[model samples]
Target: MAVYQLDDELWFPDPHLGEEDGLVAVGGDLSVNRLLLAYSNGFFPWFSFRHWKEPHWYCPLDRYVIFPKEIHISHSMRQLMRQNKYIVTFNQCFEGVIRGCSSVDDRNQEYGAWLGSDMIKAYTELHRLGYAASVEVWEPQDMSSGKRSAKLVGGLYGVAVRNAFFGESMFSLVPNASKLALIYLAKTLDGMGGLFIDCQFETPHLKSMGGKHISYDKYMGILNGEKDVELG
Candidate 1:
């Protein structure tokens, strides 16, 4: 249980230890310099401060992601896209997107998000520093009958790690906010030579977008490729 890491990069714990081993070290300030190094080297903060002693770093065994070429927009969703009922914007409502994501009502038996106040604050700080980003899809302003609700509803927040954009979390207030955002991100990745979305976990919704599972070893290769890409 060694602790007291750094504000920048450090060796990750061996996956064999699992989440319980809590090994090696933790506790690093999330500076843009630090976060960039972490993502470049296949590490990311879980956005925690439970123990002031260390910042936990994890390299899960499985990575979830989707290839832009394989995106699946259902016929109904395609129709909706055609309607252009909602508009997508980048980095407009960062805190709102994060709050929406952090507070999404988990109707599908999904409960208890690990994105706590500390995590929110940490990532929010990242947004302030411009190291992190959020993509927002706004509900049509006129759509609100009483107009509280609109077609604009979902978006996500993620970190750009070199060519690999590590997805942190996302929420959908409207019907397809998350999916629409992912679609745009996929297009961006295709242009950036992005290899994968380091989705730490799996979800059926992501799978519907063609998210595939790959070993962490392979994921590391994508990050450490010979052609180094400069991310925006």
Candidate 2:
């Protein structure tokens, strides 16, 4: 046993420092090295500075995951899919998507924008390095009129690691934009083998995509199996 244990406490200092599950440490600095290492080991920092004495690390016993092929599209969504009214593209506007996702002005979900300025800089840097990616949904306008045409509707941004994808966040300017993006993402990622999507926590939106919990060991294996991200 380690000298200090954060048992029953839902935070850990580093991935290696994590307990069997739930939490691992506290008060550790949130440096890039530590964050990256934590992710690589299936641990993530999810603390409330307002509530907790210090930052906490968590690696839940059951991880939420969605298989690409397992994505669920409703009949109404199918109609929208057939329309193809919106053009969906990858990595076209990553920062925009991140900002959209960072918005906390939605019902049911509380208004808490924790992505922070630091997060933007950090992920944007990853985007520059080609390790992170974004998907954009644009409403196409009639080109015959020669207008700039349409506005950005929705998008999702995440990090790709090997055959796995670590979903950061997503948002929609209009309803269903994010959902459409997820459908496209699932279809696109299906071609790759060993593809597993990590949705840090559970929600109704993710449940529709067949998100379920897995043993931490299983989650680690999937993350470890990924060697490099496939950019399209």
Candidate 1 per-residue lDDT, tens place, 1-232, comes to: 2334444453444554555432334676655566676677556665433334345666555666675556667787788779987888888888888887777656212534446666677778878877678888887665446756434488989886566678887888767778888888787778876676766667888878777877666666656774454221
Clashes of each: 9, 7
Q: In model 1, what is the error at residue 216, expressed in angstroms? A: 1.2
Off by over 4 Å in 2: 1-23, 26-32, 47-56, 106-111, 141-145, 226-232
Which prediction has the highest lDDT against the true structure? 2
Model 2 lDDT-worst window of ten: 1-10
lDDT of 2 at 149: 73
Question: Per-prediction TM-score, please?
Answer: 0.76, 0.79
Best-fitting candidate, measured by TM-score? 2
lDDT of 2 by residue, 49-130 (tens): 3355544667666788887878889998999989888899999888888877766466214423456565677678767777
On a 0 to 1 TM-score scale, where does candidate 2 land against the true structure? 0.79
